[model samples]
Target: MASIDSKVNLSTIPLVALNVTVRKKLGLYLNPKNIMGFSYLEITNFENFKNPTNEILKNWQAQRSEASVGKLLSILTEAERTDVVEDLRALIDEDVRKYIAFMEKKEDPPVQVPEVDSCVPRTPETLGLTVLDDPDGLYPERFDAFICYCQSDFPFVHEMIRELEQTDYKLKLCVFDRDVLPGSCVWTITSELIEKRCKRMVAVVSDEYLESDACDFQTKFALSLCPGARSKRLIPVIYKPMTKSFPSILRFLTVCDFTRPCTQSWFWVRLAKALSLP
Candidate 1:
C-alpha cells in the first residue's frame, strides 16, 4: 500500500469494501463528477499478490482500455492530480504501463498561437442558422445522421467524415461542442439535433463514450427510436473493443470494427457499407 504521511497507508486498509468516507480517510480522492456511476467500494486488493475477484477484475479491465484509463489519466494530468495518477499507476496491471507511456509520448507541447481579438462575437446567425428557443424542440431541417461520441474519438470521426464527404454521401455531421455554434444552450441544441432533426444516430462506441453521461444519454435516446439493434438507423462504429461487460443497450447491435490498424482499407470499406454509401 502507498503511504501519504506514514500515518494513513493504502496497504493496511482494505479497499474492497470502503465507502467514499473510508476512501477519503485512506487518501483516495476520486472526483465524484468523473466517477458518477461507479461504486468506490469495488476497488481491487493491491496488497497481496493474489488475483482479484471476478467483479473487481471486470471493473479493472474496463479501466485498462485506451478510452477509460487513458482519458482519466489525461484529465488528471490536465488537473495536476499527480498523487492520484502515481497511486493509480502503481495499482494498475502491467499492461497499463505501456498505455501510460504511449499517452506520455502522444502529449504535445502547447503551441503559442496568436489570438485575434474581434469586436464581433460569433453566433448561429453568422452560420445562417436561426436560433429558436423552443422547449418542445421543433427544427426545420433534418440531417441524415447525428454523431454521438467523446472528444477523444474526434480524430477518427473527423477522418471518417472527411472520407464520406469525398464521396456523394453529403453527410451533415452534428458533433456537439464542435459543429454546434458557440453560446447556444447545449441541452437544447442536442435535443433538437438528435431527437428532432436527425434521422439516424451514429455512435462511435468506446470506453470513454460508455463512461460519459452525455454520450450514454444520446445512445439510450437513439436506442429508444429502434426496438433493437436491427434498426439500420442506429449505427455503431466500434472505435475500440470494450473490455468492460457489454452494456445491454449495445449487446445485439452489429458494429463496424475500426479497432484494427487504420492503414488497412477494410475499415473504410466496412464503414462505407455500414453507412450504405455507394
Candidate 2:
C-alpha cells in the first residue's frame, strides 16, 4: 500500500471524495463566527463567489496549502459538530487514516493547552468563589442556567459550557442539545427546564437568535417566571453584533456584551457571577 503523507493539505483532496452536503455544511461551520483561533480557512477573504465551498477550497489550496486535513477535522471537532466531523472522517481515504495514526504515535506528548482567555478565571479561587451547595439547600435548583440559543450560535454556546461548566466554576447549564432527553417534546422539556430545573436563563443574543421562534419562546417563558425583571433571572449575552434592533423585552436588562473587546476580558467572570448570585 502506498503511504500517505501526514501533512497532506485538505485542498489536494478530490472534491468527489467530499460529499456536496458535507462540503456546504463545512463551509458554513468554518466561517470566522463559528470557529475560534488562527488555523481555519477564513471565508471572509473570499468575495462575490457563487459557490462559497469551492471558493473556500480554492483559497485554502492557494494560501494555506500547508494546513493538514487533520487540522480541518480538529476545527470541526472544536465546533462541537461531531455528526459533521464523523461524516467528514468517513470520507477520508484509508491510506490517509493510516498516515494520521502513524503520525499520532510518532508525535511528542501534547503541550498543556492554554485557557480560552487568560483574563477569564480558570479556578473558583481566582474568581473568589466557592462551589454552590445546591444539594444541601431546600428546593435546590438542578442547573445554574438554561442556555437559550439558535442552532447557528451553538459554537458560542459550546464556549460558554467550557468557561462555566468545564472550568472550576463547575456550573451546571441546561443546554438543549445536551440536557433534553430524546423522544420527549422539546417544548415541554424546555419549559420544565426553564421554569423548574434552572435557576436562571441565558439568552445568547445574535442576528440568528432574533429570527428564531424557538429562542423567542424560551426567552418569553423565562421572563414570565420573573415578571417585571425583579429577580434578574434572565441574562442576555450578546455574543455576536446584530444588525437589527435589540429585542424590546431585553433592552431594559443588563447585557453581557461579548462583542465589545473591552467587555470580553470580564465577560465570563460577569456571567459566572450572575449565575452564582442568589
Candidate 3:
C-alpha cells in the first residue's frame, strides 16, 4: 500500500472526491445570489463558466483558507443537501479509517491525526464508531414503516433512519433507496410494500412531497389501507417549512412537525413511539 500522509489537509479530500452532479448541486446552493455576503460579480462569472462547480469550490477555498471539511459539510447540510453531506462524510470516515489502520501497522510512535471537527475525533480509539448494521440478520423480515419521501427530502429521511433504526428505537424502516431490490417495477414494489410488507407508512411531508406524483400515490394508497388513520398506519412528518397547504386528505391525521423548535428536542422520541409495534 502507498504511504499515507500523517499531516493531511482534510479540507481538500471531499472537494477532490466530489462528482460532477454533486459539484453542480453545491454550485447552485453556494452561488452568491443565493447566499448573502458573497461577491455578486465573482459568483456570476463562475455561474456563466463551463465548469462552474470547480470555480465555486476554488473561490470558497480562497475565501476560507483555514476552513475544514466539516465547514463544507455544514454548508451542504444548511443547503438541504444532506444526501451529498452524508456521501462526503462516509468518504471522509473511510479515509480516516484507512489512515488509522496504516498508522497501527507502523513501528514509529503514534502520529497525531488532525481533527476534522468536534464530531470526528483526533484519536484512533474514539474514531472507531460502531457501524449501524443488523449483524444477526433478524430485523430483515420485519419493518416498522415504509418511509415515503422525495429525493430532495432524503437528508431528513437519512436523519430519521439514524434516530429510529440505529438508535435505541430499534425500529426497522423500508426505505426505497436502501431496501428496494434491483430490476423490479417501482410502482408494483412500492404498492406491495405500503399495502402488505410494512406496518405503517411515514410520509416525510414538505413542499417537495406535495409536488411528487409518487409520494401522492403512496400517501393515498397507505390511507386506503387504513381509512381515517384508525390504526395510526400513516404518519405524516412535516420536515420542512412549506408555502403550500398540508395535503387535504391527510389534514385530519396528526402530523409530526419537525420545523418547530419546541418539537426538535422530542421529535425522534415522539416519532419512535408512534412507529413502535402495538
Model 3, global lDDT: 0.67
Candidates' lDDT values, in order?
0.54, 0.67, 0.67
lDDT per residue for candidate 3 within 123-238, as digits (tens), equals 33222111211222211234679999999999988898788766666677888888664655567667766765689999999888889999999999999989768999999899
Q: Candidate 1 versus the native: TM-score?
A: 0.46
Clash pairs, model 1 backbone: 1-11
TM-score of each: 0.46, 0.50, 0.50
Candidate 2 — worst ten consecutive residues by lDDT sum?
127-136
| lDDT by residue for model 1 (1-278), tens | 43233342223322222222323422336423233134544442221212222223224433533324344455657767777667655444232433334445548633763665554323343322222121111113345678888888889888877766445544555656555556656555665676656777888888788788888888887777677555577878876668876567776887777776763568766655566531
**Model 3 pairs in collision:** none
Which TM-score value belongs to model 2? 0.50
Enumerate clash totals for all models, in the order shown. 1, 0, 0
Task: Single out the weakest 10-residue window by summed lDDT for candidate 1.
Answer: 130-139
Show where candidate 2 strays beyond 4 Å. 1-141
Off by over 4 Å in 3: 1-140
Model 3 poorest 10 in a row by lDDT: 126-135
| Residue 119, model 2: Cα distance from true site in angstroms | 44
